[model samples]
Target: MALPIITGFDKGDTMKRILTSIFAFMLVLSLLTGCGKKPVIPDDDDDPIPTEFTAKVIGNTSGNLMNGGQYAEAGGWVYYSSETFDESTLTIATGLFKMKSDGSSLVKLADGAYRSINVVGDDLYALTQDGVFTMKIDGAAGRILPGISADPMGMILVLDETIVFLTQSGEIYRNSIDGKNPKELADVNAYGFYYQDGWLYYGINDASYTIRKVKMDGSSTTDVSTGGRDFVFADKRIYYRNMMDNANLYSMAMDGSDVKKISDVDVNSINTDGRKLIVSSFTGVRVLNFDGSDDTVLSDEYAVTLSIAGDFAYFVSQDFSPQHNKLSLSSGTLENILKVRRIDPQNDVVMGSGISDPYIVRMGDWIVYRDSGELTKGIYKVKTDKTSKTKLIDAYAHNLTLIGDWIYFVNDSLNNYLCRMKIDGSEKGVVIDLPVNDFVMKDGWIYYTDLNEIKIMRAKMDGTLISVIDDSDALGEIKLSQDFIYYQTIGMEAGNFGIHRIALDATRKFTYLDDSIQSFIVDTEWIYYTTKVSENELPMQIVRMNLDGSQSVVMDYFDEYVNVIGVGDGMLYFETWKNEAGSVNRMNPESGQRQLVFTSDLRNDHTVIFENNLITLKNNEDGSVNVYLSDLDGNNRLLIVE
Candidate 1:
């Protein structure tokens, strides 16, 4: 698990204190800058500077536990060991467990036990306790491949219905996807392979990571390259970065001749959009012509991971510094055009101040976003066309809602203070300070979850802490109305998640929302939520419920799985995975109709807020996690804006 807070420091003037502390830390960081600083020895009578330290835990990962073993991907499904193990009890099994990418739908594929699994096309191949066998993805009919020992790393790639695989003892074999034409490829440990056109390029452990080519007919072998590290094929050439001193990008032809070094100092990852070679590392993102000349740093941010689409380069910035993150792109030796500029325009909360997490709202010609530069995480306002900016107050802002000329928001970084400010960055004042999370506004009050409890906090359009009702029972996701507040409660029953509900007022006792529910949301008469009932050891339902905890129904059921629930604009969105192939889906909260907005066979661990027809998310595409944006309908693809 990672830390809950970003280094546990609050944002604002608190950040100024942190900046001041950086000067004290300068002596320690001198070595990283290759600078030698004169050291001053303290006198024996001098007092030592004291340092304080604390640790915070975040990100609960208790539910999802993965079994360690060799597995292969086929479509969206992963077939792996389902055998539960108790280390102290010495229990293990080889049974097969099939699951989707988002960890929703899981099922036991087969009984007994198995060693490992490899999948291709529609066939599931594995070595069972009985023998090597083949099955369908949906767990229908299965049969053992007679007399064949199971390859630990079962299958690699397919060519004309024939499967090539690696066994545990560093041997290669060729067979049909359904197990036939078994033959050995001498005695070599094949680590990786790529099938392009009619030629099969495979990397084997000979002397030191050698690449050899063979025809589809298993004819004579030809050596391609040897003594390279971290190789990838792109644009009909094998591009690899050296592991030895003075790392550089090196590329070779298909026939392994005319080997050339492209750049020194480690090119991180390279991609080709058919025209330009987009390469990036810790330094920045760069675009190069095919001939390896005219390279330009296309981005100003600390470009770490990148993907190129057409003329746009989607790059992620690693520098999370508060003051200096303006994304810009250029071409032609650090002179590219600035196509899309995402300006985080700052208002004069106070001049020369930095703002973080802008929550913008519109009122008349002025667009308002919470800015906390001067007033310690307060509210700020600016024009809609990026014309002017100004700070309203020095209060912590959270859960912002706009009403008429004033912007309603919670300044909770400090004692849950409610505040309001004009859209034109003027007439800033306080409303109330109330503890809340996941809040919604209805009629006049702000209904929200407050520290494991749900409450309705009513305050004037100024900053103040007003308590409408502070219920004791834990609640989450509160929605407010003129007369009532509806919320949900979550508790642990012997480590299993349970759900409940209650009203906004302290007089109304808690109500039984559901005996069992995974997650749920409420708005007036309707309640939208999800539930999981393990049938065959796999949870398979995304459910909905009424506000009164009655008439709960399963909206969508799948054989795979769905995780992460978010709702916006009457649409419920979550990431769903069939088998192990992951995708994002959005459904009509009223009709429960669903559509796949984005899909990929990658690890997507982040789903941020839905804003302006775009949902920001972070996914691990190449080797690093990167931020991306997808549309509400999931039509427009994500891009890397540094």
Candidate 2:
């Protein structure tokens, strides 16, 4: 989900304009598409097939719960509260409701300025503008939970005796059901609360937007990092949106440990029947294990399908294109395709196209690629066999990585903010917003270079921005290890670059690794960099030094060109270029044994070698750059995307 921008109402007004335009467009479509044609109903004897008249009014404005359902459940009944933003002549607002599994038995349990609700036992306890109230299943006699905050955000039934709720001040509390001595548990200030087992969980609205859990007594507090997303309780665990990454699903224990990100895409909703977890991503619905194993999409896939799983999924899938076939992956069959009606995104624009840096990452099922194309930009998840193509999101995206079920990326549409969505395109939220360039991630945190000031910034997966690790604007080529992050900071003098290091586990206090260098790379034990002596001279040598800035020596005897390095398979692979031609060189780091792997033609300047082989961009005689792969045996082959 995109992070909420805490800005002025100007952007909100702009969004309202956009939404108004959409509404006008939909209104026009309904008038033109339906009103223009009226089917002549024959008399009772000649009527079409003797079926009852069926009319469905589905619109963002005037829709019963067709495709727009708020929640989902597996075995348990799903509860939803509905209020029309604009309804009829009166403009109705503020209502609380519940529904059965299959969109039946919609019971309006409360009304008039109710905030949120909690279901415990046969009663629904919800917050109204004035106070908290409880009512029976059929909206029968109601009574107030006396002596609770009137400004309650929501309610959670932790146990028979306890009710946890959030106040307008962002504070959380747990009190007896009778409201005896409500005790302040925590001050989230920006988030609400959820109760599971003996722990109380809440989202911290500070630098990380991180969800955390604590013992009911508030003795132990632990960060349950769901990449900065919100949490839903089901099947003895907390399922949450990946706060910092896209299209991700995660869950953890109630006590905050044993956190596991379960889905690869944005899990739109989760319904767990204790035995199976039915989850909905943007593309469709699937069932997963509580531990996030054995995930299977439960919906049919003829046309594009959105959310699905169990009942909640069944409700959510109604929102997708009407023409959908039930897809049975087990039998590889598509049947009962439904004819759907939809408002296409393409209809809003005439012609649009762009290209994205195709990023490939290895996760659960296959190698996922976020095709960063401009016009076709979206996060696409396909099995390694190239089957089951799920369009995660159509929003503009940048670099992406899949950690567990979520894909973290930079959304260009949202100010290049770090964002994530469910792999199925649900729960699109921001991780953090940064004015940065060339961002990267390690462990669970994001690191990037903000172009405006050259300072490096860090944030959690859930849209919480942390400036704890600030550096000078001259920073570049930053890389992080488990313990330290290394980068080169350009000095104020023209052509002066110095190696720098900062302990990751510490408070981000940086220390210069070396004061004498132009560019460098840090390995486990050594630092390799390029430097020159005189002002006019280019790189005089590629030098190696201890990480502590001592015991420096020139390694590669090269001058006047660009050098690239990679280390793998117990060897150091380096590329040195003379103009546009480059040679692939290798060295055994331990023995100092240097050897030339291979050399490419002058046209192949940008060469990369991996797995003891060379790969280069070859400019063929036809004036096109084609990539070629070659091995030590002199066997070369052209690599094509197709």
The candidate that achieves the highest lDDT relative to the unseen native structure: 2
TM-score of structure candidate 1: 0.36
* Cα lDDT of model 2 by residue, 392-471, tens digit: 76655546655545666666544455666555666555555443454556555666666545777775545454664655
The true-structure Cα RMSD of candidate 1 reads 28.5
Report each candidate's C-alpha RMSD, comma-separated, in the order given.
28.5, 23.5
**C-alpha positional error of residue 269 in candidate 2 after TM-score superposition, expressed in Å:** 48
Superposed by TM-score, candidate 2 places the C-alpha of residue 474 at a distance from the truth, in angstroms, of 4.5
RMSD of 2: 23.5
Cα lDDT, model 1, residue 582: 81
Shift of residue 357 alpha carbon in model 1, Å: 12
Report the Cα lDDT for candidate 2: 0.49
Model 1, stretches more than 4 Å misplaced? Answer: 1-397, 412-416, 433-438, 448-465, 490-510, 514-518, 535-540, 558-572, 577-582, 588-593, 599-632, 636-642
Candidate 1: tens digits of C-alpha lDDT, residues 421-483:
555455444343234454555434444555423433443223223465654344454544334
* Residue 29 lDDT, candidate 1, scale 0-100: 41
